[model samples]
Target: MYLRLMYLSSLINIILSFNITDYLYRYEYFDQSETTTTKLESALIKFQEFYNLQVDGTLNNDTIELMSRPRCGVSENPSEFYTYGNKWTKNQLFWYFAMADATMLKIANRVFDIWQNYTNLNFIYSIKNPDIIISFSDNIFVHKNNPRCMKGECLFPFDGKSGVLAHAFAPRQNKCIEIHLDKGEDWYIGFNKTPLAQTSLFKVLLHEVGHTLGIKHSSDPTSIMYAFYSENTDHLSKDDIEAIQYLYGKRKESSTTNTSTTTPASTTPATNTTNETNKTKEIKLDLCDIWTNKF
Candidate 1:
């Protein structure tokens, strides 16, 4: 597979949470081939399309930088991620979403977008039963209604120094995904934070969203899900993109989601032109894929 995204060398220091050597372990007994690499390349292109960037897999740092900008909603504070306490009155997961800020809305859209890219999965967020919930104050957050982690994970989206950016629960067997909103209190919904002279909110959101969609962290430094968040880095690495498309490509049984009479279902069709010929059919994409880059 051709690594389409552009790549730029960086002086930024990154610490790895997961060892790169593990991939070598997977590669040792695992079948590694251009076919797999191409699959990875395909995933990257899907993400590029989601972010409205050029469909290149070269890990272009410039493109990643551009990707950090607002795609879903504009922010007043515009910084990377922040840490704030999740001071909520109720224990219900939906309470956090009720108080979602512009940053949170953008993050939600990004999450939806990644899921939308995989046509076969056809997963959509039910505003009637939204899959993600967020409790944000500064960078720390508590989430619930998670498919896997049941009680939800306690996390920080942007704890300074790239120590801990964020985390997410896996897609549940019910075929739904649970993503929690987390960031620092000082972190801007946009890029207003002091450290983000150059960085992206959407970039981090995209990465976390990828995790919700089943993308594991990648060894490719350029990948959005790389263990470390780099300064001025945005956009999914070629490997990151490939990982998503391939994983979600399998068709799960059709699932119908109920929408609130007030909110109504958000029916976003897929953007994969390859499937356009089957006009009578529908392809589901992550809401992030359909609308984030526009914001």
Candidate 2:
């Protein structure tokens, strides 16, 4: 069944000037396929459900435009099994560095701290085997059994050549929770200081870590878990906080909290794109086909 789908997709790609593979790699939202059958149709339906799109399987202008948008690594496939069960069983989680430099480690710690500040969930750094493993790899095919990854790739390579940023696995189910970053990208500590720069390290990790905690992407563009990266995004939106809290109840209030980060009011902003078709092309983060790339 998979081989048949691939052959048909290959033929369709040859006929079309636009590369659907590249689109899927960047977004990592829906399964990328050329054949317009039920497989593609079902994937599209899942995409619409994940993003609150109208559920027509046929590709429309809106679906295509949304695909062009930036997003996180969590695949929209509803069938994938994830083990984020019963509110984590405990509030504490230990993490390890599979491979990281000083800079990546620093930013990773900061990301963990940021998440901790909001919820009762706590992240502790460990040298031993950890529940969550973080690493940077130029090798796209590294992890195949990672169930958290969605399937697809662009004809143009992902590394420094194209848009895939990074991806992560859902927690509890895998032997070790994992986050794989594309080594091809030039990463910066904070926001992109210049237009010619690479992806933001802090922002990208925040999105991926959310996946490790069982939180999925939200339809809200301002959400940290939104499938794409938005320039204005700096802090977690109310939706992000609410979703995480929903999984594991709200954080207990503390005195003398950190003042550097300001929490947004619980109300969500009204300016995000509605169900209507979006005409603008979105610059999105890209990822690899974890299984296919390995083979």
lDDT of 2 by residue, 18-91 (tens): 46544443345454554455556666676777667778975776676566443444554444432244346677
* Candidate number with greatest lDDT: 2
lDDT of 1 at 102: 35
Q: Write the per-residue lDDT of candidate 1 for residues 1-295, one digit (tens) a residue.
A: 1212212212122122322222222323122353465565654454444445677953455444433322211111111222111111211122113334333444454444454544244433333344443333234434444333344334323344223344555444433334433333223344333242323445566666665555555545566665445544455555655565465443334532321112212332211111111112223336564342121
| Model 1 alpha-carbon drift over 4 Å, by segment | 1-98, 122-125, 137-142, 145-149, 152-162, 175-185, 191-199, 250-295
TM-score: which candidate is best?
2
| Prediction 1 TM-score vs. true | 0.43
- The reply for model 2, stretches above 4 Å from the true place, is 1-62, 78-87, 141-160, 191-194, 254-295
lDDT of residue 89 for candidate 2: 62
- For residue 269, give model 1's deviation from the true position in Å: 30
